[model samples]
Target: MPTSDAVLDPAVAARLTRDAAGLVAAVVQQHDTGEVLMLGWMDDEALRRTLTEGRVTFWSRSRQEYWRKGDTSGHAQFVRSVALDCDGDALLVRVEQVGAACHTGDRTCFEAGDLGAVVGAGA
Candidate 1:
């Protein structure tokens, strides 16, 4: 994996724990409704862009490039806030989602992924 020399706040970078590919998992959510929108990966530079530019940017693992949300789809995610997980291996990106978060035009990626697991008796 190529290292990023892009500028990111030292303090924020220090808290990150990336994977072997030098990427962190980002969980995108609707700021107002708390609905999980989608999942994306981010390198330091992508994270910096998301934080500084007020838009969500992700490092595409397959395409091996950076893509800003809504650039082509017009389904943008306007950033509200971001929080690093306790383990520093993940991030929660809160945004004002404009349209479908899924490439399939679904509201969320998880919307159609229910496995029908047996419900456990729990409070």
Candidate 2:
């Protein structure tokens, strides 16, 4: 569960109050390995489920369903820590991953090579 200090932060609380969408982006990462696993979205229930279950669960925007990160793929993620960005509209979930995090069987979703060298040194 998030500390009271985090959940009670005025900035965080403010962003949590979405317009009519009831959604927020969640960026998932591996805690120990420092690898990005995946990105998903969350609603109030999804947030509660992740905190309560200590697992990485997301609300599927396309399917309109709740997805438990390794439920079918056998790549479950155990929560280690969670943070809200300064704007409080997004979340960073640090987790302990069990297996391949990406559905495509890649270690990370961000597998593209750096193009900074070609993009004027840094884009």
Candidate 3:
């Protein structure tokens, strides 16, 4: 049997604890590098799309719509694997990031120059 999202039952989605906006936390990470790319939220449909479409999709809270990473920016993230946190309230998605993952064109959304400088200074 081919293991595809189409055939994979989504019954687990109902067990997730969503935020007040009906979104579950989704953390995107690079599969090989283990670099955290970005954090997004997903509703049931968004989760379904991400699994079935093979792309990291998120539900935009402000826009109230579904946005697939790299759709317009050409920085698509292909899902390699998905894992549910122990609490079942969060999702970690390992992906193959193509191009910049951040909307600002940075490799990652997290930029802590001060933290890096502080850590390096002590070393």
Candidate 4:
């Protein structure tokens, strides 16, 4: 796990610990279009991969591997910026998406509702 040499502020560290098992949720979004691309999980490795590779990579809970979002589907998400929520248990990854963000041939995993309706539904 990555640690800062600087002392961690308790408030910040507390906020970052909602995922007690060392995992967090990452929401991928299109940087230019502002479209939500996909949702995935991240372990420390996944986070490292995204930061290091400059692409969206996730830890598949079911597949139990590090999954690069578009490795197979060709719907690559090129990361733009990563933001952590106030709680820090979740992340928002803005990216420059290449193709369809969904495996089902859709633009985004969140193609159902408008932003107003799904604000708190957990991205």
Q: Which residue pairs in candidate 2 collide?
A: none
| Candidate 1 segments exceeding 4 Å error | 1-6
Which model is ahead, 3 or 4, in terms of TM-score? Answer: 3
**lDDT agreement with native, every candidate:** 0.94, 0.78, 0.84, 0.76
The sequence of per-residue lDDT tens digits that candidate 4 reaches over residues 1-123 is 444344434553455644765788888878777777788888766776787689887877787777798789887888789888877789899999888887788888777666675456666
At residue 94, candidate 4 shows an lDDT of: 96
Of the candidates shown, which would achieve the greatest lDDT relative to the real structure? 1
**Candidate 3 C-alpha error for residue 100, in Å:** 0.6
* Candidate 3 lowest-lDDT run of ten: 1-10
TM-score of each: 0.93, 0.77, 0.83, 0.74
**Candidate rank order under lDDT:** 1, 3, 2, 4
Which stretch of 10 consecutive residues in model 2 shows the poorest summed lDDT?
1-10
* Superposed model 2: Cα runs more than 4 Å off: 1-20, 112-123
The runs of at least 3 residues in candidate 4 whose Cα sits more than 4 Å from the true structure, single-residue gaps closed, are 1-15, 18-20, 112-123
lDDT of 3: 0.84
Q: lDDT of model 1 at residue 100?
A: 94
Best by TM-score: 1
